[model samples]
Target: MTERVTLITGASAGIGTELARVFASNGHRVALAARRADRLATLADEITAGGGAAPIVIACDLEQPDAGDKIAAALAAEGVEVEFVVNNAGFGLFGHAIKLDRDEQLGMLAVNIRALTDLSLRFSDHLIRHRGGILNVGSIASFLPGPGMAVYYASKAYVLSFSEALRGELAPHGVRVTALCPGPVPSEFQARAGFLPGVDSLVLNVSPADVALAGYRGLMANKRAVLPGVGIKIVPFLLRFFPRGFVLSVVGRYQLRKR
Candidate 1:
């Protein structure tokens, strides 16, 4: 059988790194893109040494305006079409919106919203042309409006809406689009976001490897929305019955309150 190619963003560590491993083990050629070239190189080397095909590593900040186009161009140069797409690059800011730096918010939007949308739109076209698949990693935060993390939650909400709507639009072409909405996955997320200083570990968390496995299964099943972790799965459903204002309030308090 011909090798299938997958393109994953934020592929250096956390969920991205684990996702790359799972996809490679399942026999898909991967294109791993991240800002941390050193980490990506190490991972690529390990994949090769472990007898899996080495993925193309593109060092992209994604906050840079041209990152998405660069990723597309690199893939074109390789002459290997991407059959699977994973848009998993994102970050969160821990402070109140008013207290956060303006540029910091912009940077957050750049990676969390702009880059993900660019890749989804760009790669969905590529997938449509090839009749393949797309997997977008959104957060369970999408179900509510977060106060301290307002922008981040809204960005993921956009991801959830955009992916589900696109799935309906792309189904006719044999293209499958799934959005994996995981909650509080134990990852570089809190540390990188600088939330480790204030947040309690008691809040729900899951392993990145577990998220990757759920993502792989969700994409294969063509699930519209994949919310792994039973506790996390209950969240989105609970949000539906409650008032939006109420959910937002809870998110704000939970996110901002230091235990």
Candidate 2:
């Protein structure tokens, strides 16, 4: 019998890799997608050694316009029916929009916003039919404005908003949609985003495994939003009581402090 696979984007490392482990540990076959095929191959070997089925590795860059279509077609060719989808592949740029490379900022949008949306829509039909669901990886930055990292924060806001609306629409059809909002974690994100040295120690760094576990639980339980850390959970709640300008000012100062 063909195994129903859980497709996780950015599965080569960090939260995405941990998410794959979570699904596979619980007996779900996984399909790993990322630009790093070597890392995916290593992870697949580990999973198979631990007695889970070998994962299908699809190596492709999500920044391409037709990336989502390619992923869908690859799954079809392999006869792998994706029962779960985790849109965890995303990146951030840490700088003023005007000062940063416009193409790089736009590329972040391509992967974080456009790719996520396209993949979700492409797999929605299969999910609805198979009683499966989608888990989108958002960020606490989504709740407020970010000055230094404007585009990255705004992109995540779209993720959280879109996930919530989609959840409502899919609920009656037995398809679950969850948004996983995690704060700073010990991952490649900070490095890729160009955080200053020793900056991560300034704040609490949560583990990718913990975030993945929280996300998995929320996705299975059909929660609207999953905030992994307690400190992170209070952010969105408090933002509601403050004026928009005040909130923006606070967020901007925080971003400035990171520099």
Candidate 3:
């Protein structure tokens, strides 16, 4: 019989790395994917040492158009079928949309949007056969208008919406889909986005390990969405109390201050 494994992207660090550890600890053989081969190898070694199944490491940059195909091929070569998918690979830029490098923003979309959608859909047959699940990493930014990080926020919005719709469609097939929306966690994301966390981040931040455990539990319970921190859980509800224009202005000003 072919082995079954959980495929986690962005598994080299931050929330992604924590998710890998959480899933492995829970008895799922994992396949780790990221751009950093060295980091993935180190994580794989750690997982094996902890008594989890040795993880399959696929070093890949999700910005490539064929990234999904490449990942699928790698798994097929290993003779393992994907039983769960974690679309945790994503990044953002902090700037006015017009001021950011056009190509860079598009590359972000390629990874955050394109690769995510591709992987989520590509293994539908395997997921159905295994009665498995999907966990997508989104941000509380998914719920609001982000004037400063426009494209990144928009990409996360797509992730949330797509995950919800996919959950409904796959429910009858015994496949779970959950969007894990966290407020902010200290990670390389801030550095890459050129963002410096301020007071708001301090108030909303949740640790990556906590976020990962919440995500694993949420997915197992078949919840539609999981907001890790109490602060993050309240964001969507609070958004309902504000006018869109006012919210936009507030976010714009806050992001500007971070610059």
Per-residue lDDT tens digits for candidate 2, residues 162-229, read: 99999999899899999999988888888999875354333545689999999999999999999987
Q: How does each model score on TM-score?
A: 0.94, 0.96, 0.99
RMSD of each: 2.0, 1.5, 0.6
Give the per-residue lDDT of model 1 (tens digit) for 1-259: 3345799999998999999999999888899999999999999998888888878989989899999889988888877778888989999877787888989889989998888888878766668877888898998877778888878888889989989998999999999999998877777888767675333334446689988999999899899988877778777677778987887777778776642
- Candidate maximizing TM-score: 3
Local distance difference test, per candidate?
0.85, 0.90, 0.95
Candidate 2: what lDDT? 0.90
lDDT of 3 by residue, 153-246 (tens): 9999999999999999999999999999998899999999998889978899899999999999999999999999887788899889999999
* Candidate 3 Cα deviation (angstroms), residue 171: 0.7
Ranking by TM-score: 3, 2, 1
Candidate 1 to truth, TM: 0.94
lDDT of 1: 0.85
Model 3: colliding residue pairs: none
lDDT of 2 at 61: 95
